[model samples]
Target: MQRRSFASAVSAAAAAPFLMGAAPSGGDTPASAAADKRLKRDMVASLEAELQDRDTARAVAAWIYDIGFDWTPATAPIGAFDFLIAYAFGNRPPANGGDPTKVLAEPGPMNELLADTVAQVRAKRTLPVYAQWEIAHFLTEKYNMSQVIAINPVIAADGTITYLSTDGVAAQIAEKRKSTPGGVGTAGVVGWRDHIKRCVLTTEGRGMKAFAPEGFTMPDTYDPESGQPWTRRRDLYLVHDMNAQWQMKRTELVARMYPNG
Candidate 1:
């Protein structure tokens, strides 16, 4: 959220991101930060407060899907969001105009496009995680520091979806920690953690093509199924193992770290 290239090198000013989460830093690194300790503490506390309200949780869900749902015109949270999710995934032009750039620029036309986008997301994909990543790909780069969300979905073995939030202490450790000397972005956190838990380790290493465009070739064992990128590690985890232990770790970590702090 602080425009620190947590996902991709998404420009903060313009914010055209590839994705919001990291692609596994090849090792287990802590989720520490360089910001003032007091500020981080306050921000975490504020997020906790926000989650207590029903309205806030709804808004957060919409935001997690915003990239595909498109930023503005978030009134129709479910249906509207679903449409944009489709439009974004389709990578098709809006009905208002042939060019998405032009239509997106003008809110009048963009709103119309958004309405249509929601339908597309619904028609094509049932899961909205794809759309969420798309938005994170861009928004996470330049969004204001206060505008961050943790929409990581952890599916339990029993077919339960537990969306991980930034409100958790362990999840916070997955941020772009900068305290380590000579290892600013090299050491990975969230993406890597998901990969380890979700995807089966190959003879080579973590597979991450789904998270990248076709051109950015990774490793040999990184081959993902069609439309299945490493970004969807949560889903992979579900397919491989159906457990909520990871989510439990985050929950426990929160109590230990903020014990009446």
Candidate 2:
């Protein structure tokens, strides 16, 4: 079965399915770009502040992870991290030399930043595939095989896969886990088995359903390319990891959320 993967899964998205190409010319005015030095200062301070707390750090890490998946290493997370590190130590005297790894690995940052980054991702949730790429890309002379933290892949409903990680600035993210039903987000598992909450797509691939959840039933879903609407149909057994494909169920779905029986 296939499901949605993203930076976040909370709160329903916009009223209209993302208008795609362009708006009707009546949108809020866009802000001017920040100066490089100002951007650097803000980013460094944001990193430092975010790293102070475990939850925020994890969120930062998740951002890096999704960024990688969205753009691969063509968009490195480390440049920002290095910038933050340099800022932290630049004010200090030469004798108190700053090493990026040493500062990041210390107690104040470490796991604290990693975990916080996770929360930020969930809170700022949006369509993962719809994220920005040019804004994230950073040209580098050397390609480091690994950043500070490498993350698991978040597979899309269309067999698209994404891997996330950290840049090692003030951001550090602990490994995240979906430990409970409430933590399931859009994962195949829903509420309880006896009072199960589930989602399904029509065999004809033009309709959908999300049982028992408020605002989820017959949601305002649509195809990105054809811009067509889906028709409702009887529920299908949703077995296997739904992240693979929205309509692609690999195994016979069971009443239970676990064990794949």
Candidate 3:
């Protein structure tokens, strides 16, 4: 499948958004760069392409049966930017290793996304949602959803906390499935449209078939403080799109190298 390249869609350099003149981050203040009509058209077109695959539809159907048969959980991996922003901006880490409980104390875009995921679960027969790091903490603590496969963060010998990346989370889910009797090998991945394709690919790399439904995209609202939209910050959106492309390609290469996994 020849997916549209975000690079081709947006003429701006992938790093353009972070430069000095870059548009303000967050809130309703529109970035001059993001206002490029051509970029918006191409981006929307490319993002829409992410859902044209038949696998997504199949995944939705599979979820119905798997939920009834064995309660296969859908994975809700957090986006990297969400954590980086909070961490970079004086969100103090808990003593010693980073504590998921103490991280992301206040609600943000990720919380809104998880809320949508939780709603999907409730609407779709109450299956578990597999989550990691701050996302899992919110799932179990804020929403009080017990049907969750929460992947804990890895604490290093130096007490440094390293949360699992998307691939790492997929590996954990795969490993968990291996030990459980009759664990369903198929999973649904809940994520933004731009990032969901990569999420599905990483899950597949871990030896399980995965699918991501369409329309669960980033919120369009602006932050009152920064006036930048969650994913609309021209730089942030381009960076994510480019990164998703790279990660998807890397996942394909890795899968080829380790076919047996």
Measured by TM-score, the strongest candidate is 3
- What lDDT tens digits, residue by residue, belong to model 3 across residues 62-124? 322222222112334332101101010011234354455434323345445655564554454
Score each candidate by Cα lDDT.
0.28, 0.22, 0.47
State the lDDT at 255 in candidate 2: 26
**Residue 201 in model 1: lDDT:** 15
lDDT of 3: 0.47
lDDT of 2 by residue, 67-148 (tens): 2212111111221111111101001112344643232212122122222332233233321111111111110111211121
- What would the per-residue lDDT of candidate 1 be over residues 112-169, giving only the tens digit for each residue? 2322332333344332222223233333343321222323345567655443332232
Q: Is candidate 2 or candidate 3 better by TM-score?
A: 3
Pairwise lDDT winner, candidates 1 and 3: 3
lDDT of 2 at 52: 66
> Candidate 1: what lDDT?
0.28
What TM-score, over all chains together, does every model reach?
Answer: 0.17, 0.16, 0.50
How many Å off is the CA of 239 in candidate 2?
42
- Worst lDDT run of 10 residues, candidate 2, spans 82-91
- lDDT score, candidate 1, position 122: 34
Task: Let me know the TM-score candidate 1 reaches against the reference structure.
Answer: 0.17
Q: List the residue pairs that clash in candidate 3.
A: 26-226, 26-227, 26-228, 27-223, 27-227, 27-228, 28-227
